[model samples]
Target: MTFPSGGRVPEPYGQSSGANLADILERVLDKGLVIAGDIRINLLDIELLTIKLRLIVASVDKAKEMGIDWWETDPALSSRAHRDELARENAELRAHLAELERGRGQEDPSLERGRVSEEPS
Candidate 1:
């Protein structure tokens, strides 16, 4: 083939074009990327199964900037969340115990005295 300037063909799409895999990954992480899709299976025109997938790729700081800090409050991923969960459970148990004590006190007036018998002998 005759070409103007030196007779050289352009590289194919798969060939290196200066942008390597690392450079592409760096750009994706810096700007953040989201991939979302849904899959549905139908049987006889009736929906049988559905799967929705969502993925986000970004640095921790970028994720935080987007208000995606679920791991911070997830009990499985955070010790602070575990402590908060325990405190909430402890408070609930204490409240339940107090309610039971109040109910028991109102159920029996003679119990306040030394009499332990529930019925006359």
Candidate 2:
């Protein structure tokens, strides 16, 4: 097919004689039932289908992916998971600080100076 910009676009399914455009496309995409893509697929005994479409619409940041441990693990789908995690972590840290405050008789001026944890050696 030709675009208005004079670009030749490769049609996925050809314009057919007997079948309509949708019908031809559906036959190739749905009924023809061929699996070919970047992602992996594992079918057990050929009874059930397991289609893995690796659609990287945009570039993803890996560090964020590693930090959260979601999208790969954690089956629970939550839109506010990252915010929830931050809230939970903040709560835990507050609790710890409270404990520390309780442990020491005097208030720690150093602790209040905005200390962030460094990775353990």
Candidate 3:
């Protein structure tokens, strides 16, 4: 099946054939098992992923040209901005708790959504 993102939605478990099953099993069980290597799994609960490799390699000039500030703005990453954000978040949490204590029924703040836009292109 084709997903909305136009990526192939592979057959669900037990729907695909023997070759597909073999491929899946090999990929899961024999990862890093090439050239005299071996892979081990618990098969109890899901094997806790030991390490996740996330490689993002770009030429410095190209990255600078694109204004791609790697790790600086990502929330999951630990940076000074993240720490500052945590501090701000703590302050906001305190403010929100104070507001709740003061008993303002939390209806989400609404902005003007009356206007509709016409497609230009």
Candidate 4:
């Protein structure tokens, strides 16, 4: 396909039509594949932000062999840890809310009266 910029882009599925799909899959799964790219945002010749993205495609066993299994231990991905963290956070927020309510409840009426007395009658 020809782009507006006159650059020729190959078809998505046609690229591997001549090659053996099984051979490509075996090679990729065995050695793994790393696709990396950088995205930049520029405003009026000034670079505002830059983002780097990296992706790895491999079999589950291969990925684990590479020591890249963070999802296994991530609290959000683990049911027990997720529930524990949520419960702890909920208890803390409840405690903080109770403390604030207690402080408001203990407010001195004399302080309000003093402020009222200082105002013009």
RMSD of candidate 2 to true structure, Å: 15.9
lDDT of 4 by residue, 16-121 (tens): 7657787888889988999999999999999999999999999878999999887765788888778877899999999999999999768899987887899997
Tell me the spans in candidate 1 whose CA falls farther than 4 Å from its real position.
Answer: 1-19, 110-121
Q: Arrange candidates by TM-score, highest first: which order?
A: 1, 4, 3, 2
Q: List per-prediction Cα lDDT, in the order shown.
A: 0.88, 0.56, 0.61, 0.88
TM-score of each: 0.71, 0.29, 0.32, 0.47
Tens-digit lDDT track of model 3 for 21-101:
777765644332223333446567877545444443444454555575766677677578788889999999999999887
Better of 1 and 3 by TM-score: 1
lDDT by residue (1-121, candidate 2, tens digit) is: 6889999977566544446866666555443333446433547745355555643222124324435345633335555776677788899999999999788746566764434244344
As for lDDT, the candidate ahead, 3 or 4, is 4
Cα error of candidate 1 at position 18, Å: 12
Error of 4 at 20 (Å): 1.7
Worst 10 residues of 2 by lDDT: 54-63
User: Order of all candidates by lDDT, from best down to worst?
Assistant: 1, 4, 3, 2
Which candidate tops TM-score? 1
